[model samples]
Target: MESASLDSRFSKPMLDGNRSAGSLEESVSPKPLPVDDSPSAPPKPPNGGFVAWMQVAGSWCLMFNCWGIVNSYGVFQTYYENEMLVYRTSSEIAWIGSIQAFLLLFIGALTGPLYDSGYFRLLLATGTFLMCLGMMMISICTELWQFVLAQGIVVGLGAGCLFIPSVAVLPLYFSSHLAFSIGVAGSGSGVGGIIYSIAFQQLQKSIGFGWASRVMGFISLVTLVFPLLIMRVRSSNPKQKRKVRKLFDSSALRELPFCLFLVWGFFGFAGVYMPLYYVGSYAIETKIMPPALAFYLIPILNAGSVIGRTVPNYAADKTGSLNMFIPTCFGLAVLSFAWIGIHNTPGLIVFIVLYGIFIGAFMTLPFSAVVKLSPHLGVIGVRMGMLCVICSFGILIGTPVGGAVLRQGGWISLQSFGGAALMVSTIFIIATRVAKVGAHPRQKV
Candidate 1:
């Protein structure tokens, strides 16, 4: 009878690491002085001592150096066009960054699951080494394929590893304030973008491309220390080793929320990169705007994005993720169709701020929504990887499409393309709502 009861209790999926009692008496009655079930206790919340916060801060620093620099690649787009890769079309140059972004999301599919099973140290070390090596190697590239392999493949993979581990490990440290912590940590991208933008611009002129990239590579090494020190995974069931296999789980794609998320990602990328790719060029083409000012706005947009990313994440935790996400999508659609279409100085600035905020919210809220919709925390990496696969399709298509529209109809046509894409995002946001309703008729906001 005791064995049967124990088996029944252990069979419950939610009780995977928990103990079960045979009866009320077994649960609460006083036992012999030597009786002990301490080994079966659930994992405790991390103490989040100074060391914990330090770890979080360190993760942010690494993210800033890697993912943050990835976000700021727009600054280099114009420079590469004028100097090194003059033969490449604007669309082709855009592909380099697009692939970089695509890989950042695409590689997550495998890394997420690997991380869940307890390869945190291995993953972080691999990402750090690859990223530093890729940056250093990129300094010598003078052709398209070299850039593609070094920047597109290697750096993309490194950023992908960095992204999943940083996000996944944080939950183990802070459960209640996860959103806030993520927001604070995510701000690293913005800070990194600003620093690199300034450094790359100044150093490209003073130190040359090789040394500028080498300097950034050195900074990446300094930022990797936090992940080395603070990341930890507390296993609830030590006897159960995390089984490793091919990490991509296609089954997650069938779920309605993830499908809607893919649609959202496609349109989201289609709209977000329009400004990133075109803003400086647009400013230069107008001839009235100075080159320095045009270069200055990219980082400014990213600075606003830092705030946009953090604040909406905090708000989404209070409000519903869907509620925050949908409105931001609609707002971006409006900013694209309306403000960017105007083509004047004031109109362009307004579009930049509006789009930055919406994109910031878009990035933060979607991950939160994915987590909320997932059936189990253990599979978050897999689910996130699946989401990235979908998102990569968007990144792959978005900028080149925008560039094509610009070629065919000029700035006006590009704005129209952005608007249309954002409208598609709004449609998907509505689809998400419908999917939620179908899943739970009486579900509250």
Candidate 2:
């Protein structure tokens, strides 16, 4: 009885000490600390553990399978025009890609919030099923509306599901190594573009359109398995409650940095994909290249882009995203207006190679900039979703506008339109910089 009483007496204080330790750990940890103090805490060590990096690589492969084929839609454009949708106008055909790009960005408005609320597994699985289904369906499509439903809507929705979740989840896994992780993931699009471009080109000749798309569908199925297996959320903090108490926060939109970035998002997307839609067509029309050779260039450009995406993102993490982004914007503008506008054979080839490099880098850096601009992990999804909404408008309209320009004056009109769009985009980028300067002028390095 005396020993039992002694044990009971020891257990009380042990419980109390454990409670106190829990409280103290929560107070000291980086996550629960105040926002003002977060920057002061030493940055998280690059804890890109093997499992974490593996997940990033897996996400990369998944993205290549889903969004990469979207990038290679140019090859399909050439094939579909001559074969399947022969009656469709170039402008009409352009909508297939436009709708696909539109869904990818527009759906993010909802998916981003869903992701922030912690439904990642559901989202990834649903996306994989939709993407595979869409690719398989596209093989059987013959009419314009059918293509729209299969390729445009279904594939677009799937891309949306896959793309944003991969991006949103990366920050949860790696804090200091965020850029490196994202850069690696972003390259999947480039690699996908190359692989799909070559595969579709060859399969179109050997097995015909139906089998060609089926091959892509099979490849997508294989690629998607990794993300389902490996990609996981690791943040310790609970998800931000998306209740009526927090439905809308207009105050966030008021921030100058976010507003400026919104404009940058608009301009950035407007010019980025114009080349993708036209490069193959331009190559064939110029008489210096065969249709097959021209289609192969998309992947070649994407190959260069793999380097472009990775290198610039590493630099952005060091030098500020805006610092890396401005020069790339200027490079794209110059390449589009001057080099691409003027070149015939050699100039077009050189322009595509150089432009692909800069544009790929440009695409990767913007997301890092968004994360830096809004450090509140809770709001990252909403902020990025809003940005995507604005950017979607640019993407939706940019290609149609390019198509209109092409119809009016042919190649010269398209070059001028692309060039002018880039210039306008650069203006917004500069304005973003000015806003940044004004917001933190006295703050020193």
Candidate 3:
């Protein structure tokens, strides 16, 4: 009876001391175990392996067909304004491209939720069908609404559907080296722009507009199949039904760093495509380069982008994605400013190459940066979707607004606008970095 009473008295104080220790542990010291490595912890990505790389290859094909064609829109914009849709004002014509840009970012709002809920194949098949169908439809379009409906709305929706999964799914297979892999995959966009731009320029001259677009449709159909066959999600809860109410992650908005980066993307994209859209025309306007040579500027830019996309991403794996991204944004801003003063072919070519390099790096680094900021792989889709949806507004208005300025104030004014937007965007990126890791130069961000 005396031993039992003594045990009971010691147990109560021991429990109290343990409770105090727990509080002190949280307050003053690191836990013995990592929170992320507990039994109910999230599944880890493979980081790198054969299947992971094949996933990258598949994603490459999708990006090639989706963003690739969008990047080539400058070629189309110039073509329609000069020959096909000559009856329309530049601002009116700008709306078609704007709508296309808007959908590319905007449709992620729906697709992101679907992807996270395990609807990968359904989204992929549907996207393939719509994108191919839209391209074929573009061939037959001779009217403005037809272009807007087919190219802007149909193609944009298809591309957006294809894009979200490719970007979101791949990151699930990689925790480290994500920037490099994504950069390599994204290089397809540059390659696709080069192929489509050259094909459109040559084919339209040889076979006519209708056939050129059909040929592009056929190419997209072929390339997109590879991705559809190989891509999938590595789900931690494959059998669990996704909550309908949880489709969007509202908590992401509370992250000041993520929001700052989103704003950075917003204002950055506002002028990102301006050079691609207007460089060819600018060349023709200055009469410095022959029309034939002027037509090559977009291709030149895209060619340089191929290198820019791959190389910076490799470097970003080490120096930090946002670290590299900030300087590139500044470089792009300077390039936009300088593009306005180039009245000679050599200078134009130099500008195009530099612009391609910086923009390629700009496009390549941001996605990986977003991935770095996410706490869970499952939430990646939602976060990326939201960023795209938010940035879509900037891309939507960018070309139309720039085109309007072009119509009213000439090339100098448009250049200034593009440059200003980029400069402002760089400031936001710096703010994002500050919020993330503070001002320590050695910090990886």
- TM values, all candidates: 0.85, 0.85, 0.88
Q: What tens digits encode model 1's per-residue C-alpha lDDT throughout 1-445?
A: 1323333222111121222211111211122111113554334435377756776786687678666877778777877776788788778888888888888887766676677667778888888988888889889999988988887788888888888777765655555556677778888887787787777777888999999988888888778766677666555567755555345555566778668877788777767678776777788777636666677667777787788778988876666567677788888888877855455777677667777777767777776676555544334455566677778888888988887778778888888888899899888877886776554433322
lDDT of each: 0.70, 0.71, 0.78
Quote model 3's TM-score: 0.88
Q: Which stretches of candidate 3 lie over 4 Å from their true place?
A: 1-44, 242-248, 372-379
Rank candidates, lDDT, best first.
3, 2, 1
**In lDDT terms, which candidate is top?**
3
lDDT of 2: 0.71
- Candidate 2, residue 391: Cα displacement in angstroms equals 0.9
The digit string of per-residue lDDT tens for model 3 on 1-445 reads 1323332221111011233323322322222211233232335666678888999998888888788888888888888877899898777788887888789878866776677566888889988999999999999999999999999999999998988777766656765556777888899999998998999899999999999999999999999888877777765544545433234566677888888988887899898989888887777777887767778888889999999999998887667777888899999999999987888878889999999998899887877677556543334456666777778999899989999999999999999999999999999998988888888877665
Model 3 residue 211 lDDT?
98
**Cα RMSD for candidates in order:** 6.9, 9.3, 9.2
Kindly give the stretch of ten consecutive residues in candidate 3 with the minimal lDDT sum. Answer: 8-17
Give the CA lDDT, 0 to 100, for residue 374 in model 2.
51
Better of 1 and 3 by TM-score: 3
Clashes of 1: 1
